[model samples]
Target: MLVGDRGSVSAELVIAIPLVLFMLLAIVQFALWSHATHIAQAAAAQGLAACRAQDGTAADGQASAQQLLDELGRGPLTDTNVSANRTADSASIQITGMASMVIPLLHLPVHAEAAGPVERFVPDLAGGR
Candidate 1:
């Protein structure tokens, strides 16, 4: 508690505040990335499910993927979209999203993909005969 030490608190605050703010910004960015990833996964799953249920008349799987992305992506990933395609044996989906931050001038881009074969189950109405 000396007269010459009067500025120590101010100095400490000035340094600590920026550090804390930086960490918070980073955390927000991380959360946004995680949320975007989750939404992408969900979209992929929807696409796969739609492919499995396709009736051979239209490309419902692609529409399902896009719909899921639109519904799940908000906030940092609001401008995201999903792409999907189905081949003879399998279906695949991809997601695109972005995250922006003020500190350090950062804008993060996120992309992910998921794929699986169309599911099928043979009916055993003959009771294992």
Candidate 2:
């Protein structure tokens, strides 16, 4: 091989390595964002389940969501918030947070919501015979 040919491979590698690393970092970042979204959705479902139970309160739902975040979501979610709303026949839960940052300049948002009918028994409308 000629002296000029010896340096060509080195030059190509030097240019390509950074691009490959960047791609890997981007993939890892996407995975982190996806995982964070799933965690948020699961937390919202847990809260909704609590609120939909008989005699459940909005506070119970909020607490359940927060507890799930505390126990299972440490690195993937930040600035977590949980909210619950309940009506006479239905209940809902919402969760919001920011996904952990893998790149210093990029930010990803995460959100999830769930709803269900409140458990209750209704008497028959027809008059008893």
Candidate 3:
């Protein structure tokens, strides 16, 4: 080891250690965000199915989404809001929330939406048309 560079390793570690730790935390934070997003999407799709059924109501859609969140989202997802709407020809559901925080002051938001034409029976029109 050169006498002029005797303390270089110590200097490098001072910078390298924090950088490595930050990278690891970033990876963990991203994983948590992804998991939270999937949970929201599943809940939204389930609620959309309930809302799009021929006999389903808007309340049913919201309830289903809330229930799914309660069952699956314990820590990763937080401050969730579920909304549902049905019109004459269509139905929709939205799930929105924040992912659990890992990096301080870094709040990640998660959102999911599901929509489809209302389920209904229609007579064959091929012959008529």
Candidate 4:
């Protein structure tokens, strides 16, 4: 090794190790955020389906969403909020949560919304009056 370049390897390692670790952690964090978002979307869809049913209520939607979150959002997703709204013509469900952090001090938010027309029996479509 040259006298002046003797410590170059050590210096390079010092910079490279943390950079590599950070990149790896960033990839893992992205994955966690994606998974959390999927969970939130699934919960929202479940609640929306429940609330849009013929006899479904907003409370039913909220309960359904909260149950799903309890099952799946306990780890990858945290601090979840579930909301449902049902009106005469439409029903909607919203789920929001923070993705579990893999990188220190990095918090990612995940949100999902599902909405559809409320189910109803139509005499014209059902061939009955």
Which candidate gets the maximum TM-score versus the true structure? 4
Where does model 3 exceed 4 Å of error? 123-129
Write the residue-wise lDDT of candidate 3 on 21-96 in tens digits. Answer: 9999999999999999999999999999999898998999999999999999989999999999999799999999
For each candidate, what TM-score against the reference? 0.80, 0.89, 0.92, 0.94
Output the lDDT of residue 95, model 2: 93
lDDT of each: 0.72, 0.93, 0.95, 0.94
Error of 4 at 73 (Å): 1.1
TM-score of 1: 0.80
Could you give me the TM-score of model 2 versus the true structure?
Answer: 0.89
Clashing pairs in 4: none
Output the number of the lDDT-best candidate. Answer: 3
Q: Tens-digit lDDT track for model 1 on 50-89?
A: 8765452116767887776666676656567667777767
The positional error of residue 64 in candidate 1, measured at the CA in angstroms, is 0.8
Clashes of 2: 0
Q: TM-score of the candidate numbered 3?
A: 0.92
Clashes of each: 0, 0, 0, 0
lDDT of 3 at 26: 96
Rank by lDDT (best first) = 3, 4, 2, 1
Q: Which regions of candidate 2 fall more than 4 Å away from where they truly are?
A: 124-129
Off by over 4 Å in 1: 54-58, 100-104, 120-128
* Candidate 4 Cα outliers beyond 4 Å, as residue runs: 125-129
